[model samples]
Target: GIFFLLLFIFLFQILYWSLKYFDINNDASLFIEDLEFQDKLSEAIDLHEIKKSQEPAFFNPNFISDYKGYALGLSNEEIDRLHQYRKAKKWIYSAHEFQKITLVSDSLLMKLSPLFKFPEWANKQKVIGAKTKQQQFSEKKNLNDINLATETELQRVYGIGEKLSNRIIRFRTRLGGFVSNQQLFHVYGLEDNVVKNLLAQYEVKGTTKISLIDINTASSKVIREFIYFDREAANGILRYRDSAGIIKSWSELEKIENFPLDKIEIIKLYLSL
Candidate 1:
């Protein structure tokens, strides 16, 4: 009886340790699966096809963070780090260095490897180094030579798309040629990633004429030039202005339903009266 009791206690001890160490509660597995799904879903969201109606869906960081956490078994700190990494280029070590990154796991690092490629190009170029082959090619393709180049010519640039090219041309017609690439970011529908990619490849020549687009007088086509305001949002802004009268101040934009804070902030820079 004494021997049997001792044997049972030994088995229980082993089970307890296994459960504790291995996280037998199943939370880890669930979290890892959730992160995988989030990654797949994110990839599936075609940034090109995304409309103003879809902006709300895309902007919800909480939803994205929560889903990612479940998929990757990430702690709050790990989730925050992931978002920071996405928003800006940051230090991302290898899977072996996961222990060094607080709250990050080796498995999570492996999963995120696809999104976190090292900036090899960034390293090669010094701050004052001569232009790279890509940069030279980009500079040679100037937007000012409209007689030679069409909308397709602009699209050849790393981040320039059909929508972006159209916006650029429209802005050029309104205010003249792009004096700076920073002005491209002011155009509606252009993503920050696109702007960053453009800045990496090309340097804008000359000074930008900082024209404040009058929200009251600006056409739908003109208003939609801002990247955040899709066709629907532009129409909504017009409709509200027509019905209620011109937006006297930026604060009046808050009255418009579904006008996201981030979008408002972006629009504020370009809007006047």
Candidate 2:
């Protein structure tokens, strides 16, 4: 009986080894990953659908903020390029024009262009608003509209060459349009005679109101950006403001070493108490 049991165990072991060697599934895939493929594909499709359904309502291409630009998938460099272009008193009115300035990818343009809602007038080549001097007045247009004065109008002033006129315009732009004709003194290369010539022809009359900076509260950076204030002068003002809060009067500026004592009267025009 023991011998027969041993012989039966040996036969069973031989049978198991033979079956394992001949197994048809040995060369085939261990498991089907294709089963999970449909689930992943469905998940991706649902995400795409959700994004499409939740599209933003309205955005003015004219004023895309940093966050807005980021949400719209714009790179920092691309957004900055658009801002720099706009800072020079230019506007982005259309999808093509926006793409031209920002230079976004073609795929991104396609995605964002459909959402662009520009001002109605942007559709036309030239907007109807803000007519030029030529359009607003007749050929003999001699008015002291220095803020609205074109290069040609500026050239009409004696001693103001193309360079001088352009310089004046640039100064005006940097100051967000001049507050007073006295601001022309900020223009470089302008001789006393040329300034008198400019004064005779022009004064600061514009459509935009000047927003004065509160020297007491303003930062060094804000003061530095001022047309007349050099970096040292701006920093000095900030130091004074920090040490002694709520500057009561311009007389306190006398103590600040780098303060522009010469331009105090003119600087007063753009500073609040």
Candidate 3:
């Protein structure tokens, strides 16, 4: 009886160990499957992120924030430059102006410009309702020559106060009369929307004769006196002039390092070769 009892105990012990081994193997199998599933989920998430980035979405560049800029692949410096421009209360009217301010690469601009959604006024769309009665009357009377516009008359436009009107008039006079409507962009303290409103009513008549400065012969001081040009531009012109001996064509100035090419067209109105 003792031998039989001992044999029964040994068999029971063996059976318990076999069941425990099977349970452990089953748990290991489940853990391996779980790890595989986790890896696949991680890969799917990564792919989704990459695809989202590749797809372009329309956005207004003027309103870009640091986080948005980073997602759009803009450098920190480029983002900061855009923010600085906005902080000055200036608006970017076009993709070209955005590129000019941010100084982004041409390839990046091409990729991103298609996604830029500018304001309707930026497209030169006339918002009739936005104009004042005085502006509308002036347009109808054919007395919309900006060169002849008085401070009082200019103040009639929306958002054009006494200070802004005075600034515009002073700048116009300093420029010896605007040769082109494009010169309006050069006026200091002029808001982009205000300029648009003013343009809708008035045109640069070009009736006034302008005394353009001789580019080759003008002194740096004289060049700096022009509102469109600064000390840096004045120095660049002199350097280019010295190197080329004489600036025969306006296009040659484009080769000058750090030259403001965007302002060249308007700048040419006040300069002669």
Which predicted model would earn the best lDDT? 3
In candidate 3, stretches whose alpha carbon ends up further than 4 angstroms from where it belongs are 1-143
TM-score of each model, paired residue for residue: 0.32, 0.44, 0.51
Alpha carbon lDDT at 110, candidate 2: 91
Clashes of each: 12, 0, 0
Compared with the true structure, the alpha-carbon lDDT of candidate 1 equals: 0.59
- The Cα RMSD of model 1 versus the native structure comes to 21.2
Tell me the tens digit of each residue's lDDT in model 3 across 46-111. 999999999868877867878999998999999999989876756677777888999999999998
**lDDT by residue for model 1 over 112-208, one digit each (tens)?**
5444432323222232245687866775565343322357877887878888878767766664445444455666687767755655545455545
* Ten-residue region with minimum lDDT total, candidate 2: 120-129
Candidates ranked by TM-score = 3, 2, 1
Candidate 3, RMSD to the unseen true structure: 15.7
Give the range of the ten consecutive residues with the poorest summed lDDT in model 3.
119-128
Q: Model 1: which ten-residue window has the lowest total lDDT? A: 55-64
> Residue 23, candidate 3: how far off, in angstroms?
63
